[model samples]
Target: MGLAVIDKSLFRFDGVRQRMGLLALLSLLQALCIVGQAHGLARGLVEIWKLHAVSTLVGPAIEFLAFYALRHFCDVAKQRISSKYGKYVAGQIRPQLQEKIFRLGPQALASRGTGSTVTMLIDGLDQVKSYIEILLPKMTDMMIISLVILVGVWWQDWVSGLILLLMYPLIIFFMVILGLAARDRSNKQYAQFNILNTKFVDSILGLPTLKMLGVDKEYEGEIYSVSERFRKRTIDVLKVAMTSTFALDWFTTLGIAIMAVFLGLRLVNGTMPLFPAMFALIMAPDYFLPVRQFGDNYHATLDGKNALHDIMSFIDSPETPQDTETKWEGWKADSELKLEGIDFAYPVGSKPAGDDTQSVASHSVAMNAVEQQRENEDDKKSDDSSESKDDSKTDSKSRRHRGRGKKDAKPIEADADGKAVAAQALTQPDALHHVSMDFKGYGKIAVIGKSGAGKSTLVNLLAGFNTPHAGSIELDGNRLENFNVAAWQRHISYIPQTPYIFSGSIADNIRFYVSDASNDDVNAAAHEAGLDEWLGELTDGLDTLIGEGNRGISGGQAQRIALARVLLDKSREVLLFDEPTAHLDIETEYDLKKTLLPIMENHLVILATHRLHWLANVDQVLVLDEGQVVESGTPKELIGAGGPLDHLIGEMGGNQIDQYLN
Candidate 1:
C-alpha cells in the first residue's frame, strides 16, 4: 500500500505536503510545551501553545484539498499519462492472463481447474481494489506522521531522538522475520483460494453434469473446508502482524522507561532543570508514537505487496507492448484477408507449427467403419454381382478420396475449430514466432480450426488487440500497425465471447460504445441483433435493467444484447464476433444469425465458431491446421477437398451432414 501510494500520489509543494507540514508544526509546539515545563519556562510555553493551536486546527481544512487531489487528481493524471500512451493498459493486461492459458491453449484449460481461474480474474482482483485505494493512502499518512515524530524528538532531546530513530530497525527486523513466514502462508492461501473458487464456479457452471454424474451435492462441506483453511491462514497472517505491533509497543515502553530513568537521575543530581526535564521526558514517547503505529500498519503494506505480485505478474505477461513504434498497415478490408508465410505456435516447445486441420490417420477408422457397413449387405448376395461391383467401385472411390472420407469433409486441415483468439490476449505470449498474415476484401468470413489452432490469435490480430511478431496484419489496407488505433477501433465493433453488462439498462448496454446514441437508435440495434424480441418481453423493454453478469437473463439473451451493442457502435468496415452464439440454442442461434446477416452486409464480419452449420453462407472460410492455413474456400469447395474438416463435420454431426443442414 505504501508503494502504490507513492507511485500514484503526486507529492507536491501544494496542499497535502503543506498540510502535513502544519500538522508537524502543531506537534513541534506541543513538544516545546513539554520542554518548557521541564526547563521551568511554563509561562512562555503556555503562550506559544495558545498561539499555535488555532492555526493547527485550520491546517486540516486546507489539507482536505490535497486528500481530494490524491483521490481524484491522481485518477486524472493516470488518464493523461495513458492518452499520451495507448489506452487499455489495464484492459490489455487481463486478456494476456486469460490468453496465456489460451496459448497453452486447450491443454492448459483441460488440466487446470476452471473455477480457480474464474476466482483469480473476478473476485481476487476485485479484492485488491481496497488495498490500492484506501490502505495505500493511510500508509502515506503514517509515513508522514513517522517523520513528524523523528523531528519533534530530535529538537527536544538528542538522546531520546536517537532512541526514536533506532526504534524502526529494531521493529522492522522482527517484522521482517514474521513477514517472511507470513508471505509463504499468504502464497499458500492464494493457491487454495483459487482452488476453492475454481471448484465453486465449476460446480455452478456444470451443475447439470455433476447431477447427472450422481454426485451428491457437497457444497456445504467444500465451503466449510475452504472457509476453515482460509480462516486458519488469515489468522496466522494477522497474528504475525499483531505480534509485530506488540513488539513495537514493547520497545516503545522500554524507550519511555529509559527516558524516565535518565530524567530521574538528571533531576535528582540537578544536572537538568526540573520543568524542562519533566516536559521533555513526557513528550519523548509522543514523538515516537507514529513509529509504533507504522509497525502496526505494516500488514496493509504486506497485503498490497501480495496483490501487486498478482496484478503486476498478470498484467506484464502480455507480449504486446503498449507503446511500440512499430506500425502495420495494408492487410484486409472487412473479410478480405491474405496470409504470407504466417507461422505461430504456443510459446512452449511442445507443438509443431501446422494448420488447424485434422490428420487423415485420426479419421480413417471411422470412415472405414461407415464404408464397411455400407458394403456388408451386398457381400451376402451371390446373385447381386453388379450391385456388389458397383459398391466396390464406390468403395474404391471413397478410399481414393483423401481425409476421413466423411460427407462434406473439407480436409484434415480443419483438425477442429479451437477457441481463444488474439483479440482475447490481454498480453501476447512470449516468443510468439514471426506470425504474419494479410487479408483483403473481407466479409462474413468464417475462421475455423481445431482446439488450440490459434483462432483467437487471428481474431485479436484483426481487432488490433495485439501485434504479431515478425509479421503484419492489416484491416482495410491499413495494417494493424498503421491504423489510427482510436479511429480504427471506432469503426470496428467487437462482440466478445464473454460479454460485459454494465450497471445500467439494456439501452445503456447497447449504447455503451456510442454515448450519444438515442433510445430509438438503441432499439434499432437491438432489433438487428434479434434482441428486440427479448426486449419486448420485458416491461422496461429497451430500458430494462441488465444487472452485472446479466444475472437474470439467459446466456443467449446476453449474447444478443452484446451483439446489439456492436450494432450501436456504428462501425462502417468491420465487426469481429468471437463466438456470438456459442451459448445460444440452435433455434435462437438460427433466428439471431438470420437477423444479423443483413446488417453485416457491406461490413466485414469475421467470426470464430465451432459449429460450421451457421457458417455455410460466409464469403470465405479459412480452415487452419495448428497455426497455418492449409485449406480455405467456400464450404462446398473445402468439403470437395475431403479431409480433416469433412471427417470432423461427419463425426461432430453424428456421422450425417444432413443432421446439421436442416
Candidate 2:
C-alpha cells in the first residue's frame, strides 16, 4: 500500500538491482515491439478496407507477426531473470534468520513464541520469494513500458494520448485509497493467522497432557473455533482486495471506451485518416495495461511486504549483553565462586500510567504461581532442560521464575470501597535479592528450597542462561561481571533431573561431551554410570538407537546416559545438578545415588534438591527460603539445630533420617 513497506534495502539483496535493471531494459524493448505490432496491424487493416493489392497487405502482416514474437521473447527473458534473482535472495535470508535465532538463544525465542518463529522461517520466507519474483519485473514494466506506449499513441493521435494520460492519475488515486484499505485488512488477517498457528502448535505439543486430563475434545473445539475465525478474517481481506481490483478494471475500461469514441468521431468528421485512427485505437489499451495489472497484483504482494517487515524486525532485535573479551582458564579443584548482593527480576510487560508497578507485581505473582505449579508437575517426571526437548515448553515458564526475592510485604491491599485490590504496591521484587554465597575447592554443597524459592533461577544464572541485574561474581579470586562468559561455562557440567537423550546410538549419546572418545573410554563411562547392565540386555548393545521418535527409554536410563556424558568429559571439574534424581522412584533414586556418590568426589558439586536424604552425603548445606539463604553450615550441624534445614526435614515427614542412615 504505502511505498514505505517496500523496504529499499531489499533491492540491495545480492544482484537484485542489477537483474532489475536488465529486466527494465528488456521491458523497454518489448514496449517498442508492442507499438510496432499495433502499427503494422493497423496498416494492414487499413489496406484491406481500401481494397489494396494482396502483395501490399502481405508485407504489413509479416511485420506484425515478427513484432508479436519479439515482444513475447522479451517477456520470457524478463521472467527467467527475475525468478533466479528471487531464489538467490530467499536462500541468502533463510540462513541469516536461522543464525540470528540461534544467537538470540532460548530467552529470545520464548518471548517471540516458537510457532511464530517457525512460521517466519518457513512460510514467511516463501512468501517473500514469490513477492520478489513477481514485483521486480512488474515494477520495471510499469516504469518503462507504460511511458513508451503512451508516447507511441501520442505520435499516432494526440487526443487519444491526452485521454489515456489524464486517466493515469485517476486510476492511481483510486488504487492508493483501495490499496491502503486492503493493506490494513491484510495485516489484521496475517496477525490472526499467526495467533492461530501459535495456538495450534501449543495444543499439538501438549496433546499428551490434554489426553491424560481428558480435555482433548475441548481443546479440539477451541482449535476449530480459532481456525474459523482466521478463515473469516481471510475472506474479509479478500473482499476488499477484489473490490480494489474491480475499480482499477472499471477505470481502465472506461478510458479505452472514451478513446475509441473520440477516434471514431474525428474520423467521421474527416479530420483523421483511417490508418492513424486505427493505430491509436489499438495502442490505447496497451498504454493503460501496465498500471492496471499492477493494481491487480498489488494485493497478491501484500503478504510478502508484511513478511519482510516481520523478518526485518526480528533481525534488528537487540541481543542480550555478553562480554566476549574476558580471558581465563577453565575451572579447577580450588576454584572459588562468590556472589555478593546479587539481585534479579523477571522482565515485565509495558504497563499504563499509574499501574506500572502494581501491574508488574501482580503479573509477577501470577507468573510465579504458574511456574511453581509447572515445576512441581515437571519434578514428578524428569528435569531435563535441553533445548531440543524441554526448552520450547519450559523457557516461557522459567522467565516467570525470574522475580525479586523479597516476600510481598502487602499480599493484599484494600481499595476505598473496602474491596481487596489485586495488586497495589510500589516496590519491585527480585528473584534473588542481596544474596551472597561462597563455594571453594572440591566438595558437595546442597542448595535446598521449596517451589518458587529461586532454586532453578540460581541454576539458570550460574549456567549463563540469565544475567543478574545487580551485584558482582568472583571466580577464582577474579571479579566477573556475569556468569555467561564462555571461559567459565566450558568447564561446567549441568545435569538436570531428566537428561536429554539425543537421536543416536547408545555409544554416541555416552560420548556427547567428548566426541573423540574411544570405545574403551565410552564403555568405562557407561560402567561408571551403571549403564553396563542395561546395554548388555539390548540386542545392539552400545549401538542401540534411542531418543524422541525412536526407541523408548526409561527416565532412569536417560539420567544414566547424561551421567556417562559427564564421566567422559574428565576436563570438567564443576558439576551442577538440579534435582537429578527427583523424578526417579525410591529404588531408582537409591541406585542413582550409589553411582553419583563416587563421581561427586574431588569435584565442585552443587546439587539443588528437595530430597532431604541428600544431606547425608553433602559436606555443606545452604538452606534457601523465599529466595534468601537462611542457614549455612555442615549437614551434621544444621540437621538437628531446629533451623531452616531442620524445619524443611520436618516438613518432609522426618523419615529422611532413616533413609539417610540407610
Candidate 3:
C-alpha cells in the first residue's frame, strides 16, 4: 500500500533519487543502532541477574545510551534530507504548473471553473509538498529498517522470527483492504473540495447580481447545500482513516503479545539462553514499528498523492502547437491574413488522458456516434425515392439562398417574420464550422451576429486564445497551422466586453503593454484614449489607484484604459475586439466609439459585435449565422440587397437606431 501511492513522476524531480539513496542508508544505520541498543540493554539485564560488579554494569549502560542516541541522530538526518528535497521539488513544479496554465489560457480553464483552478494552484501544491516530505523517508524506513530488524531477530532466535514473519502477511492484507477504502473516500472528498471552490468563487463574483435580483438568499442556501456535502464527504474520509489506524494497531499489538508468549515458553523449557531471549523480546516492537508508522501516515498522505496526480495530469494535457519558425515582419499596411476550412469544437469534457476509465468511455461514445451516423445515412438512402420531389424543391431553394462563394454552405433558415435566424447554441458540436474569411490591407471589418452565432468564438480563434481542430491559416502568404503563432499574437491586442483593471495606478494600467513607458508617454497615450477629461477630475490624476479593493471605475472608463494600453504599444498593429461595447449604455457606447474610431485608423481591426450601427463605420461586413458566414461584402453592397444582412438588420432593430441617430 505504501509503495502503490508512490508516483513514478515523484522520482522525476531533481535530487529525488539521490535523496532516496541517502534516506535508505540512514534507515539502515538506524536499524543497526536499534539492534545494538537492544543487545546492550539485554546484556546489562543479564549481568544484573548474574549479580555482576558495579564496574561491569557501567560498560553495558554506556553502550546502550550511545546506540540509542545514534539511532535518533540517524532519524534527524533523514528528516532534514526529506524536508529540504520535498520543498525543492514543490518549488520546481510551481512555476511549471503556473506557466502551463497561462499557456492553456482561460478558454481551456472555463470547464474547470475559476475557484477549482485557484485551489489547485494554492492548496493542491501544498498537499503535494506534504506528500513528498512524508512518503520518501517513511517508504525507505519500511523497505530497509524493517527488513534489517527482522534479520537481527532471526539471528537471535528463529522461533520468534518465524512468528513475526507469519504475522506480516496478515498485517499487510488488512492494510491493503483498508487502504483501498480510504483511497476511494479520499477521492470523493477531493472532488467535492473542487466543487465547493468553484461554487464559492462563482457566488462571490455574482454576489452583486444576486442581491439586485433579490435572490441572494436562494444562492446562499445553495452554497450551504454544497458546503454540507463537502463536510459529509470529509467526515466519511476521516472515519475510514480512523478505522485503518485502529486495525493496524490491533494486529501489531496482538502479534507482539503472541511473540512474548512464545519467547517465555522457550525460556521456561530451558531451550534458549537468557541473553538471546531478552534481546528477541526487546526487538519485537521494533520489528512492527515501521509497518505501524507507515499505516498511521498512509491516510494523511492520500490527499497529497491525489493532488500530485491532478497537477501532473493538467500540465501534461495536450495544447495547440505553437508556430516557432515562421518569421514575418509584423502586420503591415498592405499585409493580408486569410483563413480556409477553419473548424473547431469544444472537447466533450475535461477528462485527463491518464484517466483510463474516462478514455474507455470516450472511445465507446465515439464509436456509438459513428454507428448512429451510419444508420441515419442508411435510413436516408432508403427514403430517398419516396421524398424525391420534396428534396428537389429543397435543393432548388438551398441553391437560391446560399451565399455567393461559400463552399458547401447550408441555406439560411427564416422564421414567419422573414428574419434570418440561424443562431447556433454553444451546446452544438461545432462552434465554427467550415468558416473561411479573407482580410487585406488595414481596414475596419465588422462581424455581426446574434447571440450564440460564434462571434466571440471566432474572435478568440483569431486572437490565438482558442485553437481550431482543423484549419489552414495563411499570413502574408506563409501557410500556418493556427493563430497560436507567437509572432502573430505578439502583434495583436484583444479587448473583451469588460477589460480587466488590475489593482494599480492609472499610469501603471496605461503602461500595461509597454511597462517601461515614461510618464510623458503614458500621459500622451491617456490623452489619445480620451481619458484626459477623467484624469482632470481626479485629485491624483494618473497616479490614482483603481481596480480591486480600490476606487471603482465605470465600464466606459475601463474600456478607455484598455484603449490607452493599445495606444501605448504602437508595435501591436492588429486589434481583435469581442463585443467591447456590449455592456455599456448607449450614451457611454457613443462616447467610447468616438474615442475608439480614430485608434482604429492605420491598423487592421476585426470587431465582433451585435451592434449593427458599427456597419456604417466599417469598410466590409461579414454576417455569421449558425457558425457559417452567410453574407460578406462591402456595407454599400450588402446593406439593402434583401439578403442575410438586410434580414439581420431588420431583426436587431438597426433601422430604428439609425433613425434615432439621424
TM per candidate: 0.61, 0.71, 0.74
User: Among these predicted structures, which one has the highest lDDT?
Assistant: 3
TM-score of 1: 0.61
Q: After superposing candidate 2, which stretches have Cα over 4 Å from the reference?
A: 8-16, 47-66, 206-225, 350-429, 441-456, 489-661
RMSD of 3: 9.8
Judged by whole-model lDDT over C-alpha atoms, candidate 1 comes out at 0.51
Cα lDDT of model 2 by residue, 198-275, tens digit: 567666755655665556777688679878987988898889878987898899899999988998898899998998
- Model 2 residue 91 lDDT score: 89
Model 3: per-residue Cα lDDT over 1-662, one tens digit each? 98888987787788888898989999999999999999899999999999989788888899999999999999999888888887898899898987786666655445465567777888988999889888999999988887988899999888888988999899999999999988888887888787777677756755654565556677678679878988998899889889988998899899999988988888899988999889988998988889888888887788889889888888876666577778988989789898877765444444532221222111211122223344465563311100001001111122222233323443322232211112221222555777889999899999887754678778877887666655577899987766778889789998876675777899988887799999998999999999989999999999999964224899899999999999999999999998989878999999999999999999999999989878779988988876678899888788767899889889877765443223
Q: Write the per-residue lDDT of candidate 1 for residues 573-639, one digit (tens) a residue.
A: 6777777776677887887778778877777778877677755678777765444555676666666
lDDT agreement with native, every candidate? 0.51, 0.72, 0.76
RMSD of each: 13.2, 8.8, 9.8
Clashes of each: 73, 8, 0
Best by TM-score: 3
User: What lDDT score goes with residue 516 in model 1?
Assistant: 93
